[model samples]
Target chain A: MDPAKLLDILGNENRRKIIQLLANRPCYVSEISSRLGVGPKAIISHLGLLEQAGLIECSVDEQRRKYFNIANNMRLEVSVSPYSYTVTLHDVTFDRGKNEEDPVEKEIPPGEESSTLFLKLSSRLKELKKRQEELAQMQQQLQVEYTEAMDHCLDSIEEIARNPVECELLFELLKNETTLATLCYNLRLHPSIVNANLIGLTKRGFIEYGIKNNQYYWKIRETGVENE
Target chain B: MDPAKLLDILGNENRRKIIQLLANRPCYVSEISSRLGVGPKAIISHLGLLEQAGLIECSVDEQRRKYFNIANNMRLEVSVSPYSYTVTLHDVTFDRGKNEEDPVEKEIPPGEESSTLFLKLSSRLKELKKRQEELAQMQQQLQVEYTEAMDHCLDSIEEIARNPVECELLFELLKNETTLATLCYNLRLHPSIVNANLIGLTKRGFIEYGIKNNQYYWKIRETGVENE
Candidate 1:
C-alpha cells in the first residue's frame, strides 16, 4: 500500500476523527456524522477516501445498514532514520472482526514498553501456532491504535479548503502580508467579504494578523499547508 | 516526530529518489542532481523537505561543500492488514556511524526470511542489556536495506509534476476523457503544446489515450496521485 497516499487521506482532521471513533467501536455514516458534527455527505466522502486507501472497511448488517470499522488485522509500522525509512504492512491473520472488542483499546500493563511487548508476543509465537495467532491478533489491534496516535499531529486543513473564497484568501495571504484594505482592493473583493474570509481563515489557524509599519497586515501562518 | 508529516514529505517522488540515492552512499547535491538528472533547484527543495522531516541530515566537509546521508540508526516499520496499521520509529542508539561501513549494504544470510530475522533479534533482546543494545544497533542498520527494498513499488512521479503545463494538463485530463484535438481547442492551447504535455504525462504513467466514439481520447491514469 502507498503510505504517502494513506497518510494524505487520513491527514484530514475529520477523517482521523472518524478513524478514532471507529477504532473505539464500529459506527455507520449518520452516527459518525452526528457524533463528529460533520455533514453526512462529508463523512461519506471521507469514508470513501479512507476505503480507497484501504484504511477502513464497511460491512452491511442484517437490516442492510452499512457499519464502518478499521480493517481487521491490518498493521503498518514505519521506522525512519536520517538516511532511510522502512514501511512494513503485516496482514496478520487475526479474527479480530468478530471476536475482538475494542481491539485498539488494549491497555499496556503499566510500565511495559514495546520491547517487553515484543518479548511477550515472541514467546507466544514460539508456543502452539493457535496461541501465537491469538497474540498476533491482539498485537495487530494495539498497533492500529499506535499508528493512529502517531499520525494525530498530521490533522489536515481540508475543512478550510472546502470553502473556495476562504481558501483563496489564505493562499493570497501566504504570498505576502497585506492589510485588509489592501487585500480587498487587490482581490477586487468588497471590504465586508474580505473581512469575513479573513475572520474565518484566522479562526482556522490559516492566517495571523500583526502590526507592520503600524498597520495591521495579515500573513499566512506556518501551518497554512495543513489546508488542502 | 510527526510520522504523517514525515510520510507526506517522503511521498514526493524526488524526495524518495534522494533517499534511495543517499541510502546507497552519501552524495553531495550536485552529484545527486546529476545522478537523478533533475535540476539543482528542485533537488535542493526536495532535500530541504527531507531534512525538515528529519529523514536526513547534512554535514559540511572540507572545502565547504555539503554532503547528505540518512541519519544513523533510524528505523521505521509500517505493517498493514485489512483492518488496521501500525507505525514504529526506533531511535536505536549505536555508534554504527563510526563502526558500520555502508550499513545498508549488509547482505542477508542465505535462506533467511524476515521471521527468522525477527526471532534472532528478539532472542538477543533476552540476553544481557548491553548485548541487546548491540544486537538492536545491528538490527537497525539491517532494517535500512529491507525498507528501501520494500518501498520499491512507490516510485516517484515528481518529474511530471515539476512542469506546470504538464501537471495542469494531467489534472485536466482527470476530469473527463477528451480527444487531443478537442483538448487543444477547449483549453485554448496549440496541438503541439497539448501533445507535448500528453507525452510527458503518458511517459510518467499519468494519462492514457484510447479510442472512444472512433476518436482517440485522453484519460488520466489512476497513478496520477503518485506525482508530488
Candidate 2:
C-alpha cells in the first residue's frame, strides 16, 4: 500500500534474485550473488522491497550483515494439486481420538460465504476421500506389480517391507527431517519408488508433502507407526 | 496493487460495512450488504481490493453474486490481537503436525512481495514440535486439574471419563473433518465450550487449530489418539 515501499521493493534486481534463490535455502547476500553471478548491491536493492513488503527476512549471525531467509511458513502450495491428509491427536487427560483435515469446504462467516466455505471444505474433503478409495483400489494393482517386482528382487514381502536401509530411512522420516532425495540416496532406492511409496501413503491419507529446498521432504505421518 | 481495485472494493459503504460483518461469516455481497442501510454498490467497491489481493473471491450462486470470504483467514491474521489458528495440519505422511499461526503475532503475506514459502513451513513444523512438547507438559497439568475437579464433582473416574458427548464429539472431529469448531457446532455445543475444550485438546497436543475464519478450526495432530 505504500508507494515508496513498493517502489523500493521492485527497484532492485538483486532482491528479486534473492527471492528466487532463497526459494531453496536461507542464504547470505554474498552467497546469493556469487551463486547468481551478480553484485551484492543488485541483490540488496531488490531485497529492500521484499523486506519492506515483509516477504523476506534476514537472520543476523552476530553481526550487522544480515543472513537473509524467507519470512516464515510460506510453503509453495501446488496451486491446484490434490493433497491427502491422515491425522491423529492425543491428549493424556482426554482419553479419545479425533479425525482431522477437511476436504470439502463449508460456510463460515457472514451468511453466504459460510455456505461457500462449507462447500469448499466439503469438496476438498470429498476429493481426498475419493482419492483414498482409489488408493485402496490401486493397492490391488500395486500388489500385482509388487509381486512381479518382488519376485525378481527381494525374496519376501517382509524383506522388501523391512529392508534395513528402508527401516533406517523410515526411522529418519519418523523424525520429520529427511527428504525423498535423502531417503533415496541413503537407502539406495530409485527416487521414483520412494516417491511411489510416499504417494501411496499419501493416497491412503497418511501424509502430505510441500516442496522444500527444491525437493520433496518426506516424513512419517503416524506417530503410532512402530518407530515412535 | 490497483487503486481502482481498492476504490472499487471499498467504494461502497455497504462493502466496507460487510468487511466488519465478515469477521463472523463468509458473506456474499448481498448478504454482506444486506445488513447495510446503504446500497449494494457500497459493499462491492470495498470488496474489489479484498478480492484482487486474493483476500476473498466471487462465485456464482443459484441467484445473485456470491463471494467467498477469505479475510478471516488472512486479513485478520495481520491484526495485533490474538488470531488463533483454527486448524492444525498433521501431515503424518511427513511426520509433521503444523499449526503455523503464532499465538502472539500473526503476520499476513505481503501482496506480490517475495513469498515466505520455506521459512514459514520449517518454522511452522518446528513450532508444532515445540508445541507438542509444551502440550505434553500441559496435559499433565490438565490431568491434575481434571482429577481435582472430578473429586469435587464425581466419585468414579470411569463415570466422569465416559463423557459421551465429549468423546463422540472427539470422534466426529476425527472421522470426516480436520477442524473442530464446525463439527462441535454441528454437535450443538456452545462455540465457547467447543473453543475451550479444543484449547485443552490443543494444549495436550492431541489437536491443533488451523486458522481459517477468525474462529479457530482444529485438526487432530497425532496418529492414534482417537483409537488409543
Candidate 3:
C-alpha cells in the first residue's frame, strides 16, 4: 500500500480512534459509534473507508448484526532525516499453515487451564517488548551516526565546490547515482547547464561518469580526490 | 509532538516533496517552487505549516534570500496489528557538544583531501544502512510473535468467557488495568452492567480487584484460573 495514501486515511482523529477501538475486538457499528461518542452515520462512513483500505473487515453475526474487526496485521514506518525520507510497510503474519509445531496453532485440550495459557502469552509479549525497545535504541544510535556522516560530507562538499550549482550537484549526487535526464528533472536545470557542471565536476575528479544500458550516469567517486 | 498531528501535516503530497527537496540542501522559496513544479504561493503555505510543526526552518542567506532546510531529524513509526495500534515519534540528535572526540566536529585543514572525507562518510553510512536493515528484520519477527500471542489470548478468552459481556470485559482488561468508571467509558456500557460483569468475573476468579487512592481497579489474575 502507498504510504502517502495510508497517511491521508489515518490523518483523521475519528478514524484513528475507530482503529484503536477495533484493535481490541470486533464490534458492531452501534458499539463503536456509542463508545466513541460519534454519530452512527459518521462512524459508518469511516468504517467504509477503513474497510476499503483493507485495514478492517466486516462479518455478520447470527443476529444479523455486522461486526467490524482489524483485517490486516501490518506496520507503517516513516523516517524523515536530513539526508533521507523513507516510508516502509511490513505485512506481519504468523503462518500457522507453514509451521505445524507452532504453539498457537495447536488446539487447546478440553479442560486445560486458561490461566496457564494467559501467563505464557503475557510473559512472551513482555519479553518481545523489552527486546524491541533495545533494538529501537540501537537504531537511534545508527541514526545519530548517519546524521554526522551526512553533515561531514556536506561540509566537505561545500569546501570543494567552486560555485552554488556545483555544490547543489554534489549534494544531489550524494543520494544516489542518476542519469543526466533525471538530474535535470530533479534539479530543474537546463540540460546544457547540468551537462557543463557534470563534465566540470568529473574533470576535477570530484565525481565520475559511466555508461550503463546505453545511458550515462554520474556518481561521486568512492576514493579520495585524485590530483593528476 | 502528537503523531496524528504530524501525520496530518505530512499527508499533503506537495509538503512531502518540499521536505524531500530540502533534505538534499537548503533552498530558497523560488528554488523549491520551481524544482517541485509547485507555485510559490502554495509552496509558501505548505512551508508555513511545516515550519509551524518544527519540521523545517528558514534562514536568510548572504544574498538576503530566505532559505529553508530540515529543522529536525526524527522518525515516526505506526504499528497496526490485530490487537494494537500505536504511533511513535523519535527525535534524532548527534550531540557533538558532549562528544569532543567526534570526527564530524573537527575542522578540516585547508588543502586537506576532500575525497578521503567523502569516502569515510560514505562507507560509514553504508555500514549503518546494513545494520539498520538487520534491526528492521528482527523487529518484524517480534511483531509476528506479538500477533500470535494476542490471537492465542483472544481464543482462550473466547473459550472461557461465559457470555459476550464477560468476553468483552476480558479483552478490554487485557490492554491495561482500569477502574470501573474508565471501563464503563471504554466499553460504553451502563454503569450497572459493567459493575455486575466485573463482580461476576471476579467471583469466577477470572480477574481480581483492589483499591488504591480510594478507587478500585480491576485486572486479570496472573495465575491460572482458580477452582474454589
TM-score of the first chain alone, every candidate: 0.39, 0.28, 0.85
Q: Identify the CAPRI category of the predicted complex in candidate 2.
A: incorrect
In model 3, state the lDDT of residue B185: 76
Candidate 1 lDDT over residue span A1-228, tens digit each? 555565455446676677766754578899899888999999999899888776778999999999988764444444443323445444443333332243432454433142233223322322333342344444334333332221221112222354766755644553357898877765668999889878876665556788978999887553312322
Candidate 2 residue-wise lDDT, B130-199, digit = tens: 5534533443443333323322212211222236554444444433444554665455677777677666
Give me the overall lDDT of model 2.
Answer: 0.42
**Worst window of 10 by summed lDDT in candidate 3 chain A:** A96-105
Q: All models, DockQ values?
A: 0.08, 0.02, 0.53
TM-score for predicted model 2 compared with the true structure: 0.18
lDDT of candidate 2 over A115-211, digit per residue (tens): 2232233334344435534433333332233222222222211222334544344334533567777777645689887777766555533345667
Question: Which is the better candidate, 1 or 2, if ranked by lDDT?
Answer: 1
| DockQ of predicted model 2 | 0.02
Best candidate (score: DockQ): 3
User: Over the stretch A1-228, how does candidate 3's per-residue lDDT look in tens digits?
Assistant: 677778888778899899988887788999889888999999999999999888999999999989999887788877778688777887775564454576645775545566567656655666777797888888777777777777777777788788888988988887788898988887778999999998898887778887899988888776666673
Q: Write the per-residue lDDT of candidate 3 for residues B1-228, one digit (tens) a residue.
A: 677778888777888888888887778999888887889999999999989988888999888989998886788878888788888888775464454576545665555566667656766666778897888888888888777777777777877788888888988887677899888877678999988988898887778887889988888776666573
Q: After superposing candidate 3 on the true structure, give the runs of residues whose Cα lies further than 4 Å from its correct spot.
A: A93-110, A190-217, A222-228, B93-110, B162-166, B189-228
